[model samples]
Target: MKMFWVLTLAGILVAGMGSRDGAVAQTRVPQKVMKYLESHSFQDLVRRYGNTTIELSVPSREARYLDSLPYRLEAGFRVQVVATTDKQNASNIYRQVKQLQLDSTYLVQEQGLFKVQVGNFTVRDSARKLLDQLYYAGFKDAWIAPATIHIAKKAKVLPTPSDSIYFAIQVMATHSRSKAEETAQTIRKKWNLPVRILAEGNLFKVLAGNFSEESMARQQLQYLREHGWPDAWLTQLLPN
Candidate 1:
């Protein structure tokens, strides 16, 4: 029911955004998610409630409910795993990634040292993609783990840019539009996230995902990295 209202509101926004005379009115846009949504149209969706909503041009089926937040089902057949060396010298890597504010974590420690594992991608292809990124980063030992599949919802308490997705490669802090655009191009083609340039004052952010879930964003990150963007990381954009 809420999803219906949200979709209805989105349609109204797109159809009623402006006039040549410069009328001023405000309707809520998922501020963080707006950039990606700009690349898509509500009419583009093939409505899940009926045959009316436009489907995202991707290959997944609609969930049983709206917002689909309560039931994020996996869309592919294979699961992916990202493996790196045992955490003997991973402290520096961890610190660097942490400083950048990415969710760098390791599995429960076992054996002689800690092993950094980024994810268990629901799709084998998605996992393999990240494996390639790890290999190029000089960690040739990464592989996929396909056995942990489950139909579950990743409860995201915060609504991220609840629109479309765009991933831009970026520096921690700076506004070099050209650099950001170049990075966006790489990811737009690679991950199909429709990358764009977002400038917040002087901090140039490489954003992705009007995406609703962290898992999907992470997969998109993996996809971008595999396609020659080794420097890309997840950029969280909160909802309005």
Candidate 2:
């Protein structure tokens, strides 16, 4: 009976392998699978997992870089010059207001209208001052409006020891430092993980987790990929 069972298992394994091989030979690879294969290259895998140096301390150059990024959004105020459904009219007004060069001017489209806003002020009084300036500058309709505004990020203090080797999950990379900082903040708030932004050349990489174990970093990487970051990967940080 034991020999009979062994023969049956061997026959099943052989049949399964033959069927799989036949299917592979007969069918074309699915487009999605092919696209995934094309997008994920061996070079990418090596870049993420290969031995690389990590500066545990923020260098002065990187410190200045981080200081330029938007830190966080806060309840703030802005001077709204106009909100009109006419796109051409809005464009004209935006161009005129932009010529004044009062502050960071933005022509934002929302709720079927283009709204021109200026200056990110944490205090309503500061926004009111801008509004007054706009009125004198021929934008009489400008008024202070409550809004969310970006503040410059302070220099980051890395917690990892300079001599320690650790693993981290790199969630994303972007050329925009502000966008990278925003993504890092969102991941930190959502997952409550220790997030770090690494500026390499022109790209800012957002990485989470300072795990001592590769297994733990892999687990976090899986979680991030399942949640939203499909391209998230585990990276080892070697002491520099």
Candidate 3:
């Protein structure tokens, strides 16, 4: 009975080897066998592992701020009037210019220094002209420092006022009504000078004195610098 069982096993092994050899000689797996193996293997893998889930989480703050930066960079020029470690000095400069109704004037604190800047001029010449005016305004330390001025847009200077051909000491221009009023009031009370807050286009222009002659305006401008106002420039109103 044991010999009979051994013979039976040998016959089964021989039959399997013969079938494999025949398949090798044919150089191809049977289509049904290949299909069965692929389907079964994939199904088994999916059953064992497909139900597994990977949970991904990111910091809420990082996710919220991923699309934007805290500060923006822009290509432009601005006249840096003064930079000092003293906040009061910077604020004083700011008030002086703001009183002149200069729209783009700002007091910024950076690197332990308070900086006062003015204008968002695209052209270097524009900044230079402003720098010249600032120098006379009493900020002799003022110069054109090329920088990305922090502002929405540059203030547009309107057409010349149509009052008459009179030259006035142009102090500054500002877009803020409160700033214009504040500056005008300070100059009026402090110096008792003739202060005119003219609305020329989008800007409120602060003029010190109106002169019928350019020469007289220049002389007055000089006197203004000698007193306290330095950024005064001789400007012709109602140009011919």
lDDT of 3 by residue, 1-240 (tens): 000101121121111121212431223445774665466555564554454432224345554564243223467678898889989878987899878655357787778989898866555665676687788878798888777743222112223345667777777788987787887888778756567788978899888655565544554554454345556667776644
Q: Write candidate 1's Cα lDDT for 151-206 as tens digits.
A: 33442333335465332334233468777777666655654554445678876776
lDDT of model number 2: 0.66
**Candidate 2 on 46-75: residue-level lDDT in tens?**
555344322223246666775555455568
What candidate 1 gets wrong by more than 4 Å, as runs, is: 1-175
Worst 10 residues of 1 by lDDT: 1-10
Positional deviation of residue 161's Cα in model 2 after best superposition, in angstroms: 32
Give me candidate 1's TM-score against the actual structure: 0.33
Q: lDDT for every model? A: 0.46, 0.66, 0.60
- Which residue pairs show backbone clashes in model 2? none
TM-score of each: 0.33, 0.37, 0.36
Clashes of each: 13, 0, 8
